[model samples]
Target: MNAECGICYEEYDWKERIPCIGICGHTICDRCRISMTSKKCPHCVRPDAFKDKNVNKQLWDLIRFTQLVFRKHSFQEEEFSEDTKRCSHCSEPSNKLRVCYDCCIQNGLVHKYMQEAEQKEENIETVLQNIRDQALCGDCVIDGVHFQHKTEYVDSFIESYSRFLNNRN
Candidate 1:
């Protein structure tokens, strides 16, 4: 039997589409499968609690191939990582924090965040110097586009430069 698109309900020829079965046995066309957004079948909402070794390996292969396919399509501008941490490297939620694994590898976001930790340890001399020069305190965490967008402490930072320094301490 031919498969159908689960989302658009369009007819799909088996030759033109691939088959993927979730644990619930809901078969979906691989070309339009919801697996990219989730491990559980979107229809069943099962936790997908466990997986055998074979399934795990297949999943990894799927992820890599999908990432590559997405890259080719320019939709791969952002990466899909299993890293659940908000910030992955920071505390940012993975849902809120998106990084293109391809770009990150090329541009070194992983290394950059690693270096950011050391940035907080800037000596008192540097901190004082920056503050004296009417600049962001050396230890200040006020970096990234979030500051300009008025996130969290950024509003308060705009209120008082001293507040930025005090918070870093």
Candidate 2:
């Protein structure tokens, strides 16, 4: 059984996890599926392989079962504390106080910057840096890029930056 998402490498959670199976019989996470520009299978590189077919219910069931078991083991003895703080975008309790990237996007700052950057033909690094500078919180940087037209370029820039930082350490 697949334990983590191939694209983001994040462990599948019961809530946000939507496993999509490509026609080539490969699975990808929901985020990557949504962000994908081409309908090709990312793993097999097959053209027009992924279709809007049925979701992998078995995978989802497994994730839910794992979540239930884990929750029982991890949080059963702990007090259920609710976060009073709310997200700026969805207005859901954020649990931690932070700027919401979705909110920033909804407010038009991200779009404005993206438009200006495209017009200027700014380098990907420069565009990402500009966004980072204006970001009110880490989530703003993490989630905002997914909504941009230059998502792939920005993602590449972030990966490169992460590698640079890791090498420096």
Candidate 3:
């Protein structure tokens, strides 16, 4: 599936450039959906088809997952690039990169959504499990990451959820 809107070719985002599902089951970006003179499916040209349509959660999840993977890969590429010096952590050519897990926990780097979910008595794990079960398919490639197993899907959901929470916070 394409990560961009068919009409404008803009990449989908969790924010303003969200993916919406038309009545005809075609994906449209939020911008294109709002810009239309009539509620029509931009891809199929079905009239009055996208009126009151909602964001497609599955597509949104996939896009977010792809974005997270892309970010991780980009960081890795920068770390291991030929021009950079080798770092002790990964033995990759990076500039003294070290992640302090204790510092992160002490600094409360964990976003507020997790606390909010706990306060609201909502089972975040269950929600993530459900998303993992329904949102991704078997051995699908999104963005540039090849998700060959269910664990990748689970990790994607976790990363996406963390990003969403971080953005909200």
**Which candidate leads in lDDT?**
3
- Spell out the clash pairs found in candidate 1: 86-92, 86-93, 86-94, 87-91, 87-92
The reply for model 1, stretches above 4 Å from the true place, is: 1-3, 49-169
Give each model's whole-structure lDDT: 0.39, 0.51, 0.55
Q: Give the distance in Å from residue 72's predicted Cα in candidate 3 to where it truly belongs.
A: 4.6
Whole-model alpha-carbon lDDT for candidate 2:
0.51
TM-score each candidate.
Answer: 0.24, 0.37, 0.41
lDDT of 2 at 165: 36
Q: Encode model 2's per-residue lDDT on 1-169: one tens digit a residue.
A: 3367788887555345567777788887766777789878888899876656446677777765665556432111123245343333333232333333454356543442333335443355564454443323235435655344232223444455445434433
Give the per-residue lDDT digits (tens) of candidate 3, residues 1-169: 3478888988776566788998899988888889889897877888887898599999877654664655333223433556543322223333333222232334443232454445443355664443433332222222213333223333544666656644444
Candidate 3 local Cα displacement, residue 27, angstroms: 0.8
Residue pairs with backbone atoms closer than 3 Å in model 3 (clashes): none
Relative to the true structure, candidate 2 reaches a TM of 0.37
lDDT of 2 at 74: 18
Point to the candidate with the largest TM-score: 3
